[model samples]
Target chain A: MCDSEGSCHVLLLEDEPMILMDLEFAAEACGCNALCATSVKQAMKHLDSERPVRVGILDVNLGEGQTCEPVARELERRGIPYILHSGDLDRQNETVRSLNAQLIPKPANANHVISTAMECVGRKCG
Target chain B: MTDDEQERSRPSQAMGNPKDFDDSPERFRDENPDARFGGASEVLFEQAMAQTRMAICLCDPNKPDLPIVFANKAFRNLTGYDEAEIVGKNCRFLQGPETDPEPVRKMRQAIENEDVVVVELLNYRRDGSSFWNALHLGPIYDSEGKLKYFFGSQWDVSDVRAARAEEHYAREMARELSHRMKNMFSVISGIVNVTGRMRGIESEAQEINDRVQALGRAYETTLDDASAGRIEIGQAIRAILSPYDVGESHLRLLGNGIRVPFAAVSSIGLVLHELAANATKHGAWTRDDGLVEVDWQEKGEDEQRVVEVTWREKFGPKVTIPADAKGGSGNEIIDRLLRFSNGCIDREWHEDGLVAVARVPIWKAS
Candidate 1:
């Protein structure tokens, strides 16, 4: 849920600028706070922060042979739920499967993205 | 006997007393007490050896280099060498630079121990062309138990090895192509979704765009990495509701993760999208204080794991039941989707807000 300032506080990890913008818009449209990260390193910084993250939306491949697995693992370890967003068809990596996180494929509708974030935080948008 | 006379008399002697010239002298002597050294049996044996398809050669172990003593017609043809050219040379003359030393060493070890050995190695013919030689070698002992000679047989297997390599390459190529094609489909689908949402579109166009977008979303979840075409219940719900901007403080969701069949993603997404749009316009999403709570859990003890999902709207504007709420397109779609999944849906209106519950069989024993 958002504070008085209307920030619901979500961790958004994506490499592509356009996709990141879409995710940001979706998070804000649903009245959730958006904390954006463009790479695994940046996402890890957000994860390390003291601020509470209600949920996470992660892109599987972050480019240059990097993945968001570490971010996903950290979220799971902290009991924070997350959803996977990827363009690659092969999404069944063993590490991610073990976490049992929800997968949302690329080019997802804003409604689906926002609602998934809401659901992760134990909320229903529709 | 003089050398020339001995050679001249051999054929007639072989023809006259065939049993005397048997390879196993002791066995021949036992069977024929009057056995002699010359017979027609030797001529018959030579004819058979010359006609056989397999290349055959005999090496004299008593000779310093184990020189080839006798070679059949097949052996001469296989090596492109005549009897005069090959007889004085050892069989090792067939081996070339490319031949693996390991098998050659094993062959030597087998010979030293007087044991049989079979080895495949590269061998060269008189024209300097190489071929794979599957060579089988064994010792031939005299009647007194002396190792008198070594017998070797050869066959060509170059074509078989080449065919296997080609098949392996083709398989690798096919796998690579499939991976590339899958990524291409995903890219094209992403493009369609992005293009459909462009501004200034008419209602009819937007509606079509929305349906296509819903399909894209369905494809995303259904063809997950596992490619099993099943969507997790919580994820499906979230994906369906993602486009709406229901304030987080105003929405609540609770559920244990469950997966549903792929066929249900689009229909269920459409229903949830319709409900959220309605709520945003006139129901729970209208006020900052308005809230919607959705929860789901697995039910029943049958082989199929059933999921019951509840959507409850609270603290919203008083809702008047729209005429279509009972029999609208949205309601029809929801009903059809539920029925397809072997599930059902029910809705209730209370003073606080509207509440709807759907029960769906998401998993079977399979």
Candidate 2:
């Protein structure tokens, strides 16, 4: 029952491979096409792609390496909804908190993440 | 009969110590002929009065300015004001700054209304030590049904206050324990998410645990340094990177620098471990000819000093465009390292080798 005119697309930006796989599984199972990116740049590329994504799942800390705040801001500006899934305490900043975005703390199962992402996207897109 | 005569007739010996009252003979001859007493009751009364620990005081109720007519030795000890000073003074002098005003006010109101009162009050001793005092005061009626005197008794309750303090401390500790447990749960969740997505299911859990354990060890080292009031950055680094070192040559530590703060050390350790693990798995040590060069030196002495680290790969399989390149593990690691605005990565992917140069901000040691 996919709606071609307004079918949902998700961008999952995670720095950890295990979490990325879990999210991918969950997104597909929920019948949503998910694009995975390991860094902010890759996520930006996906956004700039011909087929633009309308939603994103960002990990607060990418790894021992990068951050996704800039990408989150851009998504915010583009009117694209996003959720934060992270274990890093630093991500609990004022900007992130004010975005009123959903947070899926680490250790969550695939179903919970995909469902929450769907909810955020549904609320924002609708 | 008069009040004086009524008191004398019942038994003079009931007052305690017949020998001390030379006025008994005068009372019997002139006031009441039936008041003569024997030795036995007097001795018993004196003994009982001396033995009781409760502080007892007898004050005249009618005369607003009436003095304390009688008090036991315990009364003298309790008030720190000997029988001499307190006999003629009102007990209100016992109230001090820390005394609970409501109870004291209630007791005063009760006294003003001539009502019997039982109240717990904070009072001070002669030595200035404070104690919770349970005071019971009642008006003693004469045979004619006139409220003639007030009798008061006090008991100490300092022990109960101490028990309540201990209970409060225990509850605070329980709350702290729950908070710590939540943090631990989040950490475990992160570990599960990472390992669950790993290629080899059998080794995934173990690998995730190893990394978490490394993080835990680093956290402990920082805690230990904090407790000691000093940060041993080099020691913490050495401990964190212990698992990836195949031998001394594999890890060429360049900066034998001064100790860094615990916060910086933890961030740096995590970065080092991730990069080193990559080198060991896919980059240099992927083959026997692999080597990792590690070094750190301060750029300058400003508030924020730039600390640079480099990891160059010597020889390996022509670094295939990582089959899982989009969500490649290495990229994930590098991305996480750059989370701090003070951090950046400039990579050199050339025909000769692969080099990753990272710049991180450092806080000076206090």
Candidate 1 lDDT (Cα, whole model)?
A: 0.69
The residue-by-residue lDDT of candidate 2 on B24-84, one tens digit each, is: 3333234324333348755444544455678777677655765566665566667676555
Q: Which numbered prediction scores highest in TM-score against the true structure? A: 1
Score every model by TM-score. 0.40, 0.36
> Which candidate leads in DockQ?
1
DockQ score for candidate 2: 0.09
What's the lDDT for residue B194 in model 1? Answer: 44
lDDT of 1 at B302: 68
Query: Which CAPRI quality tier does the interface of model 1 achieve?
Result: incorrect
Question: Candidate 1: which stretches are off by over 4 Å?
Answer: A1-126, B1-44, B141-146, B189-366
| i-RMSD per candidate, Å | 4.7, 6.8
Give the 10-residue window scoring lowest on summed lDDT in candidate 1 chain B.
Answer: B18-27
Summarize candidate 1's per-residue lDDT along B1-366 as a digit string, tens digits: 643233334443332442222223333334335334457765555445645668887787877978877666577678887656777698899999899999899989888899999999999998999999899999988678888779899888789777878977765555444434433443444344344445533344345545555555544454332344466867767655655544457667777677666655555666666667667767788888888888888777765567777888998888777666767555677787778777788888767677988887766554
